[model samples]
Target: MSKTQQLSKIGNFFRAFGSAVAVAEATRLGHQPVASDLRALGIDPVQFKSIYRR
Candidate 1:
């Protein structure tokens, strides 16, 4: 991969990782997670809540 493309991938990896960590921490603390962070991990916030309702 080109240097720029590799850098972009690295950045995306960290961004996604950060989002996952934020969501996990929020849920652990009994707080609402950010919808954008959930979406970053390919989760739909609405459907995710519905799963808990079942």
Candidate 2:
């Protein structure tokens, strides 16, 4: 892969990792995670809410 593509992939990976961490922290705190963060993790925010159903 090109250097630019490799860098892009790394950046995306970090962003997704950050989103996952944010989601975990929010859930741990008994709060709903941000919709954008859920999307970053390839999750549908609405479905996630339904599954949790609080």
Candidate 3:
């Protein structure tokens, strides 16, 4: 793949991984939710929440 494509793939991987981790953490912290988990992962809660919701 071209450099840009490679970078895109990497970005996609991280995004998916982050979403999975956020889901797991949200399940673990019953009171909190995936948005909070995304925040913990250093992502903007609102934006990440929107992405994860998709």
Q: Which candidate ranks first by lDDT, i.e. highest?
A: 2
TM-scores of the models, in the order given: 0.89, 0.89, 0.55
Of the candidates numbered 2 and 3, which has the greater lDDT value? 2
Ranked by lDDT, top first: 2, 1, 3
Cα deviation at 8, candidate 3, in Å, is 0.2
Candidate 2 C-alpha lDDT tens digits along 1-54: 999999999999999999999999999888899999999999999998877544
The local distance difference test score of each candidate is 0.90, 0.93, 0.65
**What local lDDT score does residue 16 receive in model 1, on the 0 to 100 scale?**
100
Tell me model 2's lDDT, rounded to 2 decimals.
Answer: 0.93
Please provide, for model 3 over 1-54, each residue's C-alpha lDDT reduced to its tens digit, 9 standing for 90 to 100. 799999999997887777777677775665345564465556676654454331
Q: Which window of ten consecutive residues has the lowest lDDT sum in model 3?
A: 45-54
Candidate 3 deviant stretches above 4 angstroms: 31-54
Error of 2 at 18 (Å): 0.3
Q: Lowest summed lDDT over 10 consecutive residues: which window, candidate 1?
A: 45-54
